[model samples]
Target: MHIAFVSLETVHHRDTETNRRLRTICELLRDAGHDVHVFCAPHWGGDHPQFEQDGITYHAIAESTDARSGVAFRLPIALARAKPDVIHVTATPPGQVAPAAVGAMLARTPLVLEWYGDGGVFPHRWRRWAAGRADRLHVPSELVATWIREQGLSGDSIETVPNPIDLERIRSVDPGEEVDVVYARRLDEGANLESLFLGLAELRRKDWTATVIGDGPEREAYEQLASDLRIRDRITFRGECSREERIAVYRGAHVFAQTAEHCVFPTEMCWALASGCVGIVEYHVDSSAHELVEGLDRGFRTTSEAELADAIVEAGDLERLDYDETFAEYDRSEILDRYLVQYRTLQDEQGLL
Candidate 1:
C-alpha cells in the first residue's frame, strides 16, 4: 500500500509531540512493508526538494509567507505526482482541511484526517464544511470525537485513536535521583502554571523540591511568580529539554503534576507515567489527562488547588508501580495495527482494495 501524509511541518525539523508522532507513524508504516511518502513544507533545509530517510520519501512543498494558502495551493500538485493509495492528513486548524480534501479528491484517493484535538479555538462554519469533505476523521480522544459530532459531522465517520507511546525507549532508562514533584508542559497561559506554583507554596510546610520542565512565552512570568511566592529557591525551571533529558527528569520525580486548562492525551505526562512517576492532574473542564489516569492506582485527579497539593503530598508516599500493564493498550505496535486496520477498512469501503 502507498500512503501519503500531508502536513505543514513535521519532526524532521521541529521538536513537537505532533511532529514526533507523525514521524513515528510514517516509520512504523514503512516498516510494515507499506510505501510511505510525506508531503510537507521545506522546514529543515532548502537544498533538497525531495529526500528519502528511513525508507520513506519526503517531498518538500514550496512554502510562502502565507503558509496555509501556500500549502493549499501546492499540495494538490504533489498529491497528483505521488499517486498514493490513501491520503492521511494531520489537521491542526480547520484551514488545512481545504487543501487536504481537495488534494485527495484530485488524486481520487481516500482521505483520513487526523485531528490532534488541541487549539481551544473552534472552527468557523466554512472550515467545518471543508472538514466535512473528508471520507473519515481520526481524533486522539472521545472528547474530540464528541466535539466533531457537535459540529455536525457524522459520529460514524469519527474514530478515536490514542497517540502511541514508545514504551521501549521509556523502559530503558533507570530511575534517577528522586525529586518531590515535576511539571512538564508548555508554560503558556492555558497551562495554568500559576495554580501549580500556588499549590507548591502550600507544600512549604513539607520539605519538597520541584522541577519544571518545558519552555514557552510564559517562562519569565512564571519564574517571577515563583519568586513572588518565595518558592523560587525550591523550584528549578529547566527549559525545553532533549528527549533523554525529559525522560530522566520524569524518572527522577516522585510526582508528575499537570494543571493544563485543556489537554488531549498529553504525551509528556504519558511518558512521565510510563517512567514510573505517580500521576496527579488538576481537573479542567476538557482535560483528557483525568481519563488517562482515572482507574490507575498511582493516579490522582484534583478539583482544587488544595486537592492538588494534597495529591502531590500523597503521591510522594506512594510506591511507583509498573505502568507497562496499565499503558499496554497505547503500545506503538498496537496503535500502528489499529491504523492499518482503519486504512484497510477505508480502502475496502471505497472498493479500492
Candidate 2:
C-alpha cells in the first residue's frame, strides 16, 4: 500500500504533538511494509524537494519563506508525482486543508482527514467544505467524534482513534523517588501554571519537591510567581527536555500534576501515568483530562486548588499504581493496527485492495 500524508508543518520544524504523531504513524506504516510518504513544507536545513529518511520518503511542497503559498502552488504537483493509493491529511487550525483537499481531488485518491484538536464543527465555509470533501474523518477521542457528529457529520464518516503511545518505552524503567511532584506542559496562559504554583505553595507546609518540565512564553512569569510564593527553592524549572530527559523526570516523580484549563487528551500525562507516577488533574470546564483519570484509583480530579494540594498529599502516600489495564488500549502497536485497518478498508472500498 502506498500512503501519502499531507501536512503544512514538518516534524523537524516544530516539536508538537501532532507533528510527532504524524512521524510515528509514518514509521508504523513503513514498518508494516507499506510505502509511506510525507508531503510537507520545507524546514530549516531541509532544502531538498524530496528526501528519504528512516524508510519513508519526505517531499517538501514549498520552502519556509512562504509555506502557505507553497502548499497552494506545489502540493498538487507533489501529490501527482507520489501517486499515493490513499491520501491522509492532518488538520489543525491554520492547516492547509484546502490545498490538501485540492491535491487529493487532483490525484483522484480517497482522502482521509485527521482532525488533531478538540472536535468542534468548523464554522468557516472553506473549512467546512474541505472537511466535507474527505472520504473519512479521523478524530483522536470519542469526545471529539461526538462533537463532530453533533456538528452534523454522519456517524459513518467519523471514526474515533485514540492517540498512540509507546507503552514499552514509557514503562522501560522503575520510577525514582527524588521528586515528589512533576508538572509537564508548555508554561502558557492556558496551562494555568499559576494555580499549580499556588497549590504547591500550599503544599510547602509539608515536605515536597517538584520539577517543572517544559518551556513557553510564561516561563519567566511562572518562575517569578514561584519566588513570590517562597516555594522557588523547592521547585526546579527544567525547560523543554529531550524525550529521554522527560522520561527520566516522569520516572523520578511520585506524582504528576496537570493544571491546564484546557487540554485535549494530553500525551505527557499518559506517559507519566504509564511511567508509574500517580496522576492529579485540576478540573476545568474545558479540560478533557478528567475523562482519562476519573474512576481510576491512582488518578484524582480536583475541582479546586485546595483539592489539588490535598490530592498531591494523598498521592504521595500511594506505593504503586497499576496503569496497564487502563492504558492498554493506548498501546502504539494496537493503534497502528487500527489505522492499518482503516487504510485497508478505504482501499477495498475504492477497489484498490
Candidate 3:
C-alpha cells in the first residue's frame, strides 16, 4: 500500500509530539514494506523537490515553511499526482487538513486525520471543520476522543490509537543503578512533583532511594522541596535523559510514580510499565494516566500523599521484574498492524480493497 502523509511542518522543522508521532508512523509503514510518502514544506537544504531519507520519500509542497497559503494550494495537486492509496495527515495547522481533503478527493483515496489534541494557533471552528473533513479520525486516547466527539463528530468516525514504543530496546538495555522509586517528566509547574516529594517525605524512616528523570524551569524549586523534605540526599536528579537512559532507570527501579496534574497520555508511565516497574499513578481530574494502570495488578492508583506513600511500600511486596512482555502490544510493529487494519477497513469501505 502507498500511504501519503500530509504535514506542513515536520519533526525537522519543529520537534513536537505530534510531528514525532507522524514521523514514527511513516517510518513504521516504510519498514513494513509499504510505500510511504510525506508531503510537507521544504526542510532539507536547497530547493530540492524531493528528499529520500530512511527509505521514505519526502516531497516538498512549498518552498517556504511559512507559506501556509502556498502549501494549501499545492498540496492537493502533489498528493493527487502521487496517487496514494490512503492519505494520512496531522490535525494541526488545521489549514493543511482542508487542502489534504481536496487532495484525497482528487486522488480518490480515503482521508484519515490523526488528532493528537495538539494544534497550533488556529480557530476552534477550523479544528471542527478539520474533524469533519476526515473519513476516519484517530486520537491518542479516549480523553482526546471525547474532545473530538464534542466537536460534533460521530463516534464511528473517531478511533483511539496510542503512541508506539520500542519494547526490544527496553529488553536490550542494561538496567541502571538500582533505585527504589522512579519519577519522570519535564520539571514544570504542571509536573506536580510535590505529590511524589511529600509521599517520599512520609516514608523518611524507610531506607529507599529514588531517581528523578527530566529537567525544566521548575527543577530548582523541586530540588528545594526535596531538600525541605530532608530527603534530597536520597534522590538523584538526572536531567533530561535520553530514551535509553530512561529505560535503564525504569528497568532498575521497582516503582514508577506519576503525579502530573495534566497528561493527555501517560507515555512515560507506559514506558516504565513496559520496563517492569510497578506503576503508582496519582489520580488527577485532567490526567489520563490512570487509564493505563486501572484494574491492572501491576498498578496502583492513589489520590493523596498518604495513599501514594502506602502504594509505594506495597509495590515492594509485588514481584520484581526487569522486563514485562505484557506491553509488547504497544510495540512499533504491533502499532503498525493496528494502523494497517484501519487502512484496510477504510479501503474496503471505499470499494478499493
Instruction: Give the per-residue lDDT of model 2 (tens digit) for 181-264.
Output: 899998888879888788888878888889999899999999989999999999999998877678777877788888898776
For lDDT, candidate 1 versus 2, the one ahead is 1
Off by over 4 Å in 2: 44-48, 63-81, 92-95, 102-108, 118-123, 321-325
What's the TM for model 1? Answer: 0.87
Measured against the true structure, the TM-scores of the candidates, in listed sequence, are: 0.87, 0.86, 0.95
Candidate 2 lDDT trough over 10 residues, lowest sum: 62-71
* The best candidate in terms of TM-score: 3
Per residue, candidate 1 scores C-alpha lDDT tens digits across 1-353 of: 89999877777666665676678789889878999988876655657888887798888775632345577678787897788888998775456567777888888889998777765434655457666777888888877887778876888888888887778877776666678889988888888998889998898888998999989999999999999999999998999888878887887888888889888777788888888788898888787788778888899999888999988888877885434456777878889999999988888988888
On the 0 to 100 scale, the lDDT of residue 169 in model 2 is 74
In model 1, the Cα lDDT at residue 196 comes to: 88
Better of 2 and 3 by TM-score: 3
The residue pairs that clash in candidate 1, if any, are none
Please give the lDDT score at residue 285 for candidate 3: 76
Candidate 3 C-alpha lDDT tens digits along 1-353: 99999888899999887898898899889888999988888788887899998898899887755536598779989989999999998877677888888889999999999888766222556556766868999888887787667666889888899988899889899988789999999898899999999999999999999999999999999999999989999999999989999999999999999999888788898999999999999998777888888788999999999999999999999998889998888899899999999999999999998
